[model samples]
Target: MIQRFIELGEGYGDIFEICELARTNADRLEQAFIMYANHNDKQVASLAISLKPVGDSKFMPIYLCREGIPYNAEKPSQRLAIFEEALAQLNVVPNRFEIKHSSIFSENNLYYQYLIGILRLNHYIPPMH
Candidate 1:
């Protein structure tokens, strides 16, 4: 099976698109995620949704809004609120994970690969073939 992260840009206007993806593909929606990483000494989050492969297809798409939303336990984030609402509508709860920042890697793809490995080992996504 093939699994890939389909980035939608950092969570500015992309939050709505990510939510729409959940609503429209409700049947295939497998998981909702809030991945946290420290950037510029501030905590930021990446919102993502994992979907099952389409009928007979081997590709599973993980729609992601890369690290952008400011994250703070003391303060509520509007962007996170939007993601929560979408999750409520889909009856999906997000799995939160603290991770290494994307900047830690020389290439963006390597960052994604790191995330994929983490998810797989944690059983959040299927293991590689």
Candidate 2:
């Protein structure tokens, strides 16, 4: 199985697009997760939704709003609240994890690759097959 992260810009208006993707593909929704990273000394988060493999290609698309929103557990941001509300409607409870910031990598793609590896290592996503 192949899993890839489809970045839909930072967590601005793009967050709505991620939520829409989950709502539209409700049946294919595999997992919802929040990835928190410390970037530039600021705690930020990325909201992601993993979808089931498409057709027979085994390409699992995990849509995300990359690290742009502030991470505050004590007082969640409105955007995070919106995402949570959307997930609630779908009966999905997002799994949260703190990870190395994307700045560690030279390119965004590399950052995503690193995240995929971490997810696989933790069994959050399936291993290559």
What lDDT tens digits, residue by residue, belong to model 2 across residues 6-111? 8788655798999999999999999999989987778998899999986788899999888888988898988888899999999999999999988889998888
Tell me how candidate 1 scores on lDDT: 0.91
Q: CA shift at 49, candidate 1, in angstroms?
A: 0.4
C-alpha lDDT (0 to 100) for residue 8 of candidate 1: 95
Instruction: Please give each candidate's TM-score.
Output: 0.96, 0.93
The per-residue C-alpha lDDT of model 2 at residue 82 equals 89
Separate clash counts for every candidate = 0, 0
Best by TM-score: 1
Residue pairs with colliding backbones in model 2 are none
Please state every model's RMSD to the true fold in angstroms.
0.9, 1.2
- Write one digit per residue (lDDT tens) for candidate 1, span 1-129: 788999997655899899999999999999999989998889999999999999999899999998888999889599889999989987898998899989989999899899999999999999877
Question: What's the distance in Å from true for residue 11, model 1?
Answer: 4.2
